[model samples]
Target: MTFLKISKAAVIGAGSWGSVLANVLVKNGLDIKIWTRESKQVTELNEQHTNHHYLPGLKYDERLVATDDLAAAVNGRQVILLVVPTVAIRSVSQKIGKILQTSNERPLIVHASKGLELGTHKRISEIIAEEIPEANRAGIVALSGPSHAEEVARQDITLITAASADVAAAKTVQKMFMNDFFRIYTNQDIIGVELGAAFKNIIALGAGALNGLGYGDDAKAALMTRGLAEISRLGVAMGAKPQTFIGLSGVGDLIVTCTSVHSRNWRAGNQLGQGVPLADVIKNMGMVIEGITTNKAAYELAQQRQIEMPITQAIYQVLYQGCDIKQAIANLMQREGRSE
Candidate 1:
């Protein structure tokens, strides 16, 4: 199918990922607007092409406008990228939906956030569907992979998948953001893409905990491999395509998240492993460490789906149940031998 042309794009969050994505969109010759809730941030972005609060070191394009007004951001746009935290996605989508419902033009919605809703256990796309009706939801897509906001903001070479049931919408987003530095591949399995993106953070925390305990590369490798297994098992059980777990959003993302210092989830787990309290860790991080909530959510989902996810369970106990980090590592090590 011929892709719909995406000339103007609105990013519905001014966080690191949103800013980076907006920059990429602008680089691809699309007019971009970055929406933030804070009026001061809008003013700051307008004056200085940098988002000091979330992404301090990077300077955004002068052409990218930042605004606090959601309606103005989404109105008359060809694409809307949702980059807010998982918990805030529903509220953001609801407001966007109301605005789009009143507008004459409806932009294709693309989600960049990567976490399942805690209470509803719905993916970001699912929440968008619930908030926006079927007709509006038809244009929804999810963009995810191993790409980090830090690297993407720096215009580093990165690849990601834009998945949607609607191939036309997926291709629209692919064409909207694909550039020399940023490559986008289209996939139809939105469920697998979203699940792989969300669940990898949980395993990354486990990998960080191993590193915190001064475990060697062998231990880290084992945790990472087993973690992928658990992720694949749960993802397949949850109706995701089995091969997606091995793709960019799955093992590829998990490796980057677990190994990179840029990963807030890994950093949080590292702190926890180093004997820091969860409250202290969070206070120090000063950002959304997705793994904390994802760990709990994954644990719940595993129970509901009857999937065995030992790494997630271990991290959940350490974070929420006050289980000792050392003991958690020990418990994971003591599990019975099984086939790889």
Candidate 2:
């Protein structure tokens, strides 16, 4: 079957990632529309070409339009990028589904959000499939990577993955965002890519906790390595291609999330380790710390699947069950020795 070419694109959710993605599309010469829940942000983007609330000091291209109306944003679009937080994806998709049902044009959907739904434990793509019909699911894709919005907005060189069961859809998205500084690779392992993207944030939190405790590179490195192992194990069990974990969406993303100062999850974990309450940390964060929610979801998934993910379990305890960070670290360190 021939795939549709994507020229006009709409980005749902005008958060940092959504704005950066819309900017990149506009750079590639596509007419881009950004949808936001906040009417004030829409006004700012329309008037100033700046998303002052989330990504300050960055000017968007004049070709980019921002709107609070979902139908206005999605109508006549060939591609839609979902960048809302995982928790909000369901409600947002439901809205999009209603809007899309009214339009004759069927746009390819791509999700850039990274996290598993907490109670349902659904991947963003899975949630999309459930909300949108089979016809729409055929056009679904996921783009993930080690990219941080701050760096991507600055047009720094970044690598990312575009994964879909539909090759044409993947290629369409790959071409939509591919630029000199932003390179995208295509992969068929959607589950692996999604899992890697979701789980890396949890490990980043662990790394940040170690940093807060004044631990050196040795400890952080160990946590990162073991964290990847745990993620890979679960991914493998879930039928993900093993090699995908070694690629940009996996190890590369894991490194960046765990080490980058711009990581909200890392920052939240650092505050937690510094003796701040989770509520206080999240309150001060003023942004979605996906790792905190993902930790809970991953822990539940591991238990359901009978997968041994000690780090995820530890993070779950610390974040939810009132487990102390020091005790969590000691528990991880004292796990029974095994051959690597």
Candidate 3:
């Protein structure tokens, strides 16, 4: 299938990752527009060239612009990037779908959000396909990996995966975003890529919780290793290539999110480990902790599939079931030895 040659793109969210992606597109010479709900944010981006709330102290490209109007954002764009939090994907896609119905264009749809839908257990691509009409969407791509917006904003060397069932669409995105500082690799396993991206957060939370509980690097390493194994198990069960977990979206992302200071999920887990209430931890975190909700969804998915994800189960119990962190860790450690 011949894909649309992307020139102008719309990034539908002005949060940290969305703003960073908009910058990447601008550097790639695409006419980029970022849509946000706040008029104040648009004013800040247009006049000051910064989004202080999300990406503080980082100056954005003057060529990159922001708008509150959804129609204005999507009207003639060749690619539409969905970068909102997981909870907002359906509502944003529904609004975009209605506006695109009248336009004579089909734009490549890429989502950078990482989390499954809570109730439906659907990936972001599935949610977008459900909300947007087939005629309006060129293809749904999952852009993921160990990319942190904080580092990307600094033009750090970041490698990411652009995965889609439609290889052409993934290639189109790879061409649009690749650069010296930012690299894009294409993968066909959208299921594995998306699942790896989502499920790794659960492990990151566990890592952070371990740190908060005064455990050293050895404990974090063990948790991340076991976490990846369970991640691969669940991904393979759901029709994802097992090796995808060992790639950028899986082990790579797990490493970054678990270790980086910029990881909100890690910070949240640390607070939980320190005995702070989940509500307080989330409240103090000015960002969306995708792991919290992803933990719930993954726990349910594991139960439904009968997958053995002990780390995910332990994290879920601590977060949702009011289980003590020490007891949870003890229970995990005391489990019968099994084959590696």
Candidate 4:
């Protein structure tokens, strides 16, 4: 399929991931503007060429501008990348939808955010579809995998997946973002891709908690392996292809988020295991730990669907119900044994 010609793009959210992705587009020779809620961040990016809060010491290209105006960012851009946190997806998409209401432009809508919506358990794409009308929407694509903003900013080799119901749309994103160090793969199962990206964070929290408790390689390996089983079970129940869980958004993302120091979810779990309160961990981290909220959503989803996700249930209990960390592990260990 022939890809749409994209010369310019708008990236929503000025967080670490948004900044890195906007810079990537600029490096690809596309004019890109980033929308941030903070006016100070706009000045910092436009004048100083840096988002010191997120990507410290990393300079952005001159062509990459930052704006506080939503319309200014979304008005003429051919592509809009929603890089905001999952919690903000609906609000941001509604704002963009209002702007696109008066126009017939169908710009490609690409979302890089993970995590299911609270209360509704809706995916990011579903949230976007709820807010944006079909006429104003060109296509919705999910750009997911293990790629981190910090690593991508330094020109590290990053691999990602672009998933869409429309193959051409996925290919367009793949073409626009691929470089010598950054690679893109296309997948048709948006359900599996998004679920894999979101569910792995829950397991990563468990991994971090185990590490904080000084559990060695055996425990960590068991947690990860069993975590994949539960994640795959839930994803398959929700209409995702089984193979998708083994790909980048699945086991691949699970590994990085579970083991890496850069993972806020893992870090938060580690803090909790080290005797810190959940509230204190979130407050001290100074960043969004997606796993906390995602844990609630995933646990509820599993319950509603009658799926067995012991790790998710334990994590949720620890976070919301004030279950003791050590006791939680004991409960998990005491569960009935089953074949792998």
- What is candidate 3's local distance difference test score? 0.93
Q: What are the clashing pairs of model 2?
A: none
The better candidate by lDDT, 1 or 4, is 4
lDDT of 1 by residue, 235-340 (tens): 8888899988888888888889999998998898888888889999999998888888888888999999889988899888888898998888789888899877
lDDT minimum window of 10 residues, candidate 1: 131-140
In candidate 1 the C-alpha lDDT for residue 258 amounts to 90
* Best-to-worst ranking by lDDT: 3, 4, 2, 1
Pitting candidate 2 against candidate 3, the one with the higher TM-score is 3
Residue pairs with backbone atoms closer than 3 Å in model 4 (clashes): none
* Structural similarity to truth (TM-score) of each candidate: 0.97, 0.98, 0.98, 0.98
TM-score-best of 1 and 4: 4
* Model 2 misplaced regions, further than 4 Å: none
Clashing pairs for predicted structure model 3, backbone only: none
lDDT by residue for model 3 (247-319), tens? 9999999999999878988998899889999999989997899999999999999999999999999999988
Instruction: List residue ranges in candidate 4 displaced over 4 A.
Output: none
Clashing pairs in 1: none
Q: Model 3, stretches more than 4 Å misplaced?
A: none
Quantify all predictions' global Cα lDDT against the true fold: 0.87, 0.90, 0.93, 0.92
Clash count, one per candidate: 0, 0, 0, 0
After superposition, the stretches of candidate 1 with alpha carbons farther than 4 Å from their true spots are: 1-3
RMSD of 1: 1.2
